[model samples]
Target: EENRKFVLRKFQILYNRVLWIRDIESTIVIVIIIRAGVYTFLLVIVAFYFSNKLPLCDNEMTVCRISIAEVV
Candidate 1:
C-alpha cells in the first residue's frame, strides 16, 4: 500500500541519518583521545630526560638547559 511504503521510506531515512551522526561523533572522540595521549607521552619523556640531565651538567649545560626549558 502507498501508506506502508511511505512509512518505510521515512524510517529508512531517519535510520541512515542516525548512523551518519553516530559515525561522526565516534570519529571525533577517537581523534581527541589520540591527540591527548600523544601530548602527554611527549611531555613526560621530555621532563624525565631533562630532569635527569640537569643535576649532572656543568656551567655551559646550565645555560643550555634554561634555553631548552623556555622552548619547551
Candidate 2:
C-alpha cells in the first residue's frame, strides 16, 4: 500500500540520520583523546629537560657561596 511505503521511507531516513550522528560523535571523541596524549607527551619531555638543568644550577650556587665565604 502507499501508506505503508510512506511509513517505511520515513523510518529509513531516521535510521540513516541516527547512524550519521553516532559516527560523528565517535570521531570527535577520538580526536580529543589523541590531542590530550600528544600534549602530555610534550609536557613530559619539557620536564625532563628542566630536571637535567637543575643540578648544574645547584653546583654553581655552591661555588658562589664558597667564594663569598673566602672573601669574608
Candidate 3:
C-alpha cells in the first residue's frame, strides 16, 4: 500500500539520520581524545626540558624549592 511505503521511507530517512549523527559524535570524541593526548605529551616534554635546563636551588634548608633560571 502507498501508506506502508510512505511509512517505510520515513523510517529509512530517520534511521540514516541517526546513523549520521552517531558517526559525527564518535568522530568528535576521537578528535577530542587525540587532541588531549597530544597536548599532554607536549606538556610533559616541555616540563622535562625546562627541568634539565633550569638551575637547582642553592639553599640547603629549602630542599623542595624549585628554582627557575633567569633568561637574559
RMSD (Å) per prediction: 13.9, 20.0, 14.7
Give one digit per residue, the lDDT tens place, for model 3 in 1-72: 999999999999999999999999889756655655555455446756888652333233133121111110
Tens digits of per-residue lDDT for model 1 on 24-53?
Answer: 978975665565555545655776688854
* TM-scores of all candidate predictions against the true structure: 0.44, 0.42, 0.44
Q: Which candidate's lDDT is highest?
A: 1
**Compared with the true structure, what per-residue lDDT tens digits does model 2 show for residues 1-72?**
999999999999999999999999789656655655555455446756888543332347555334433443
Q: Write down the TM-score for model 2.
A: 0.42
Q: Which candidate order results from sorting by lDDT in descending order?
A: 1, 2, 3
Q: Which ten residues in a row have the lowest lDDT in candidate 1?
A: 53-62
Scored against the true structure, residue 66 in model 2 reaches a CA lDDT of: 43
- What lDDT does each candidate get? 0.65, 0.63, 0.58
Better of 1 and 3 by lDDT: 1
